[model samples]
Target: MGGSGAGGTNTGKRPNGQLGSWFLRSGWSKGELARQVNRRARQMGAHHISTDTSRVRRWLDGEQPREPIPRILSELFSERLGAVVAVEELGLRSAHQSPSVSGVDLPWAGPQTVALISEFSRSDLMLARRGFLGTSLALAAGPALVEPMQRWLVPTSAGGQEQPEDEPVATPSRASRLSGPELDLLESTTAMFRLWDAQCGGGLRRKAVVGQLHEVTDLLQEPQPEATSRRLFRCAAELAELAGWMSYDVGLQPNAQKYFVLALHAAKEAGDKPLGSYILSSMSRQMIHLGRPDDALELIHLAQYGSRDCATPRTQAMLYAMEARAYANMGQPSKTKRAVRMAEDTFSDAGVDGEVEPDWIRFFSEAELNGENAHSYRDLAYVAGRSPAYASLAEPVMRRAVDLFAEDTDHQRSYALNLIGLATVHLLKREPEQSTALAEKALKVAESVRSERVNTRLRKTLDTAARDFGDVAGVVDLTERLTAQLPESAEAV
Candidate 1:
């Protein structure tokens, strides 16, 4: 609730209650005004702004915004009122905008989104604090997710759009114009980064990935032909998606979500429906991990709806597999099975020859599908109270994934993850010896990678094994070995 005082009550106030008068005339509560300001700040890339009604109340009580916020509030009001609203008119003292600060507000236009990504990438790469990279912040972003989803689903026309007058525009460098060679370089760089992420995990090369994203951002400012620009946007989109995944790998969920949204916007600007769908799918995967299965389901369905007409069989298979995972998490066994079946059928229909899958989705091989199914079954088993039958069903697929992933160095993390899953299955079967052995092996492989996900999985495996078979000699030995070798943070139950 917001306090409302009539204009006549403070006609000759010293603080000049113009802001409050405007607030009352607009019929917006203090909380709503704070939300609007915070949102606008995000759009302007102010990463640390966390305003609430209390802050708004202070502003009404003659407390002024620190910096850049006054400018932001003026712009927000200007757009809403369809007239010029200067900083002085907002009854706030003007201050210099902060340098090197980036926020994660969703931009409506494609160009603005690109600029936002460019600035954020550069800031993320160089800034020490990286305050917006917190996993907890990302997990709590359900409300923030709605606006972007709506914008993607029902795009606004160019005519209805208004650019913030205070936004800093970058001048294009003549020497930085796009070329075929530059495009090739960007594409190759993206591929290299993807391989690095897959092989070594995101934490090991996250800074490098962010640096590369900054480079791409630099390229994005240059002028180019329409066709070349579109291709460049697609390439940049892929790189941004990889950067997002790398951020996720390092447990920087908020940063990951920002990059993912940037990638989505880039994909849309490029008119690459397949890439956009993949970006959405990636977002859904993150949501699923963050314990928002219903939100994850909506994003996955939106991807399917947008890409259904032109998505390749392999892409469709991947989307269905993701849906199955979401449903499994939601404890909807029937829907989970149905999505899994759809994925299987779609993959089966993907013939061996003359089928050109996008490079980004080429990872969805038979082994990947098997791994996805194994994960779904594992989730279902958990939902079923760790039933031995479901565990048994998961084991063979996990074994297959282990062997398949082992064949590719880029999939070492996946192989290790599958080993953890297999060990869990063994634990469910009360095979302490086998479980300890598999978990030990997984831990060894995980040690060579820098994935937080693999670390978390290994910790869970050891915890489960120790809880069930602490007295067993094999379990004791493995537990001691893990406690000595693993990080102190991960050694905790």
Candidate 2:
């Protein structure tokens, strides 16, 4: 595959003094150079690339690499040297250089969600913003999440999920009504989309989910009888939440926040307290991702309080576990342990009394709960100033999560993430080789999944390795794979 610029013919190898000079200046080994180039290309949406040390050696010997490779190389050099290193600066002709890589505000409006829903749906359906993307999206804080959570809590308030019984309900006669079959189709389709999302992560089929969300939101614009409204809004809530999740997986934190608000609003309209709480839990997860454990804790508390009366055992387990994660990240061992026990107890009682759970909430199975709690322990081990007690405790729990993920084949994203968690546990165990091995396994699974969050986490683990293991060979090799990734992922939300 090594050749001249895209569609250009390869000439005989001539010594590339220009590339060699920069190579010396940059100080990376050839293998390291190839790995970094491959990583940068993947970020640029070229995952099929396989640039090896041999490829880099050839490039230095003057076999001009393919179009994007030379451009990618130039960018890497620029960043490394802190200057605008052009393609030609790397001794490659820029005649056919690849081009450089380059928000919808649908607010809740009007008396009810009709105008808001209609506007969001139409705009989203018509929206097509797919281009080469490299985002620095901050997960929203303050009013972004707080206002939505408040609205969810007070269902009797304006634009609240449920219409107050004391008020006259408007069931518009001219509204386009959904038939039972149509409603069922939407429900089934949403479920199908969710299954695909579970297996593939947030990057794949994201547009399809947004499309489904649009349809549901559009239907929500038409006024309907109370029963009809409940069903329609429930579908909208589920779809919107799924869309938010997909966006979150792809690292579009701000966009994910908007979708989460839409889901919360839809749940408020349906008066589906449990579902609304679920959405809050998701927001809380986002907070944790953003390193705002305090915010994460607050969000979970709100969700728990709002759903206290009616949450199914599984739902309670999920929320409690989410709370545990927040506490773990905060280095609050006692509180984290307390919350974990609650999660375990609630999870044990999930189906004991024949309580029916929403199909969506049913996903919080033993494996999922195990994975969540494992993450909590892992965080306590590392995030809590490297507490050895928790570090010792994390390995076994994390291993169990990995085993469970292996048993559950359908949850590919979860499986991949749990593998990462286990690898982290190995990292904490001071077993650098073991950690590298486990991380390699995790990364392989991550390749089939399109979630940028997974890739980000992989980078984080490697960064940790670089800090902790110093000159360890395996750690060095793993670290070089993405050393140039994500300075902007740290931008404040």
TM-score of each: 0.74, 0.73
Error of 1 at 42 (Å): 27
For 290-356, candidate 1 gives per-residue lDDT tens digits of 7677778888888999888888889999999999999988888889989999999999877556777
> Which ten contiguous residues of candidate 1 have the minimum total lDDT?
2-11
lDDT of each: 0.72, 0.72
Off by over 4 Å in 1: 1-105, 128-140, 155-176, 351-353, 489-493
Model 1: residue 203 alpha-carbon error in angstroms = 1.6
By TM-score, how accurate is candidate 2? 0.73
